[model samples]
Target: MTATTTPLLGQMMDVPLLVSSLIAHAARHHGNAQIVSRRIEGDVHRYTYRECEVRSKQLAQALIALGVEPGERIGTLAWNGYRHLEAYFGVTGFGAVCHTINPRLFPEQIAWIVNHADDRYILFDITFAALVDALAPQCPQVRGWIALCDESHRPAMRTPVLCYETLLAAQNGEFDWPLLDERSASNLCYTSGTTGNPKGALYTHRSAVLHAYGASLPDAMGLSARDAMLPVVPMFHVNAWGLPHAGPLNGTKLVLPGKDLDGKSLYELMEAEGVTCSAGVPTVWLGLLAYMREAGVKFSTLKRTVIGGSACPPAMLRTYEDDYGVQVIHAWGMTEMSPLGTLAKLNWEQAQRPPEAQRALLEKQGRVIFGVDMKIVGDDGRELPWDGVAFGDLYVRGPWIIDRYFRQESGTPLVDGWFPTGDVATIDPDGFLHITDRSKDVIKSGGEWISSIELENIAVAHPAIAEAACIACAHPRWTERPLIVAVKKPGAQVTREELLAFFEGKVVKWWLPDDAVFVDELPHTATGKLQKLKLREQFRHHVLPSALEVGDKCPLEPLDSDKGAASGATANTKSAATRG
Candidate 1:
């Protein structure tokens, strides 16, 4: 009566899901769908899916002619444009790994990544031509360089470089894509490496294809052939959040903004191209919003935008949805998760809630997508409840999620078969994830835990504050307390006490930040997330007024009832997780 180990199989033809097939399907079904790009040449270029397919085939043939073997790593330092799109399909179509390098990283870091990835050839845009020349000496393993421009437009470089158009012209666009295993690696992306050296995430054809499907669901990005999609996210970042594959899979018109990602350029392109939906980080959207406010203009065709890479401030979300009539899709994920975990799309029941209630729910990171499974575990490694009160470390597992980092000889970083996301969060009964803070960023004072994200969100809600970041600082009596570092809007001024007073009723008194400081701007990672490590180091020796009063000569332990000092350890043990 036990379940059988083997079962009868159905009569169905099996085919491997590969990256090449997505572009082929688009070319065959929706041949005329346009792919628009504002090229670095200070002009816009347009092409169709059929043309893109032919050129992509040409690129594959060219790379192969240059002796690029399957499974080899090929790098790209380009923007989101037609040529970059061609590389996405071309390099992967022939079974080569497409490693997109972020040009914004330090030259040394870029060289280190290139050397670490063992990239055979780097296809770079003209904007990065000087960068390639500067780092070419450091990347000794790189075999060749190709400028992503025609023979006439190629820049003079210290190293020998090939012209992209000349290479394509030699090919007849008749190469056939090889039918490879679906598990073959198609893409490579490295973490920002803020703490140390960068680690890579190798994505397979099966994972990429499945992620495209999962990301295009109605509750996800809700992509379709009718929508004009503009991904403000770079091609180097998590495959632009999987838009390159998903866009062609659905035959959606892609509007690439190239190197001109400033507010004016992006707004003009979106309006000119009649963009319907977009996706990017919060910082990009903030610039666009600022431009719109200054110009007194609104989106004519833009509808919704997916904001990820970091938490979207409540104030920014409200402005996008209320003032501009655009739906803000708040999303959260890590590069290791194929970067798509949870997206805030309300269901019918949740939508029926009052405006205030619904807005509060939207602030959470939303429910997990179909491909992902999530849970919160306390310091003891026990799963926490979904009562929305208890917070713990977040863990996730899925087919698309990485089991091990590329080239990593160390043992797997998973815990009991789950990948720890290093985030402290709480989940509601309906399965919404409310991230409290990163495990390393949370502040512990008087035996109580404080969420820096919550504090920053409240700080940014003040009109005078343009951006804010809360970091844990040393305290004599409390061990560590929250301190706010903020940037004021242009021509806007507010005193430290006024900023501190703004958070009075938003959060509990115990959770309020000890002090607020103003700065010209804040440090950010290449991917647009706050660099708290640098902030913590800068303010490590900053003395608080309260600490000065107490005198740091000798530390004194507070009574049990003084400020819940005795319960801090127990509270952390039960609800918070300590990340290794």
Candidate 2:
């Protein structure tokens, strides 16, 4: 029988899910688990979960003694180290938000972000001492600056700053985590600001906790106590894609690589620490692979790596699995969704398919886990079917997703309750997401869209090509055409015609780049993403030799190796094409 009265709630204790609980659990259950870090001071620091808990509590007491109030923002300009990890929990345990600032950003942007967040106290590593001094004048609202180092190593700066160790030593590890509303803001991470000024994504305690749980599942990161994980991604970037939280939640040993993300450094650390799983962007993996190839080395314990931030090249995937016996987990996400929406893990049916078929599915971003719901929409705002062909704008909605920017007060960026991801993509029937291109980076040639990512992937597949970027060059006839900007391997040589001919059968004829140009290197964002925006600007006035007049019918055909060869087209030398 249907009752007219309100439904009675279950008689379970309503426990608030908080970030502090994750670390507390780790300390209680896995107190001996190690947290290793290569410090910026050219040394290594090791601590256990039990010691980490004690120090984190001491740090909270120090923050309280310094008059930091609940809901206030505490900024950290440090790399991934024990001190930074302490701040991650310490600042949040007492309800203050931990604002991680990307040190790789321009100084002006760092100052602007600090001012925008109105940080109370900035705790920074010694490496950024000069940067902190330079930013002090621009950030008048900041209460004080604390160096994340011992007193002996503190640098001489124009502005006075406190020592993190000195402060923590004075506090006893008797402080208790305050009971905070689960919805209270826990961390703040600003976007990379590739377009305009960076907007902050203030993550709440509840969202962070939920994201940690979701990301640690078997189908996601597959994290557990048995693993020693290294997050090559910086802690400043979306809390290192929520690894800092998930690591503690599952009692996974964490190895923090500080300031030396070079191939040799990472290789040694992983081997010495017995790291089984790692995560980072494609550019970082490229460096590691190049080093491995040069040194003829192999991982002893590393079993997998999660590649995100940008698309992982299919060639790179094959190299990892075939050459090195390491599985590459392709992931996709943004800062707004706590940076982990989908992780590439094959399902039972997909795993049972042929290896080639499985590889094809693995090439695409995996299906959503339990928390996230995604859909693709056409230009008319109509939902598109997941047929793997109808590409459209991608949208997502989930509990951990952002409802609005940190301080944005006006209209919402959400379209009909879903956050537009600013990505052009298609979803297969089995729910794999194939991101064609970023909305702004997609090439519009003759009213047709060309996937720059696909073109770049094929270009990088060439053995001689070290990296590649595909950008739109203005074409008088078709409005725009594709151009390949490539970087060749050191001492390797290939002609422009030879490179252009490599794409003959891989894609449609028209999708072939109109021209190829060799450069020393392509520009990258602070987070190791291809800076196509800068490339487009640099080549905006570049003239394509194959461009036709307004009324001319452009030939859409594969390159004829002999006919398409430009004079002195050797890739050993940089392109002599005229710049604007």
lDDT of 2 by residue, 3-32 (tens): 678877899998888999988999999999
Alpha-carbon local distance difference test for all models: 0.91, 0.91
The alpha-carbon lDDT assigned to residue 515 of candidate 1 equals 80
Clash numbers, per candidate: 1, 0
Cα error of candidate 2 at position 254, Å: 0.7
C-alpha-based local distance difference test score of model 1: 0.91
Error of 2 at 328 (Å): 0.2
Clashing residue pairs in candidate 2, if any?
Answer: none
**CA shift at 268, candidate 2, in angstroms?**
0.4
Off by over 4 Å in 2: 1-5, 548-580
The TM-scores, one per candidate, come to 0.95, 0.95
lDDT of 2: 0.91
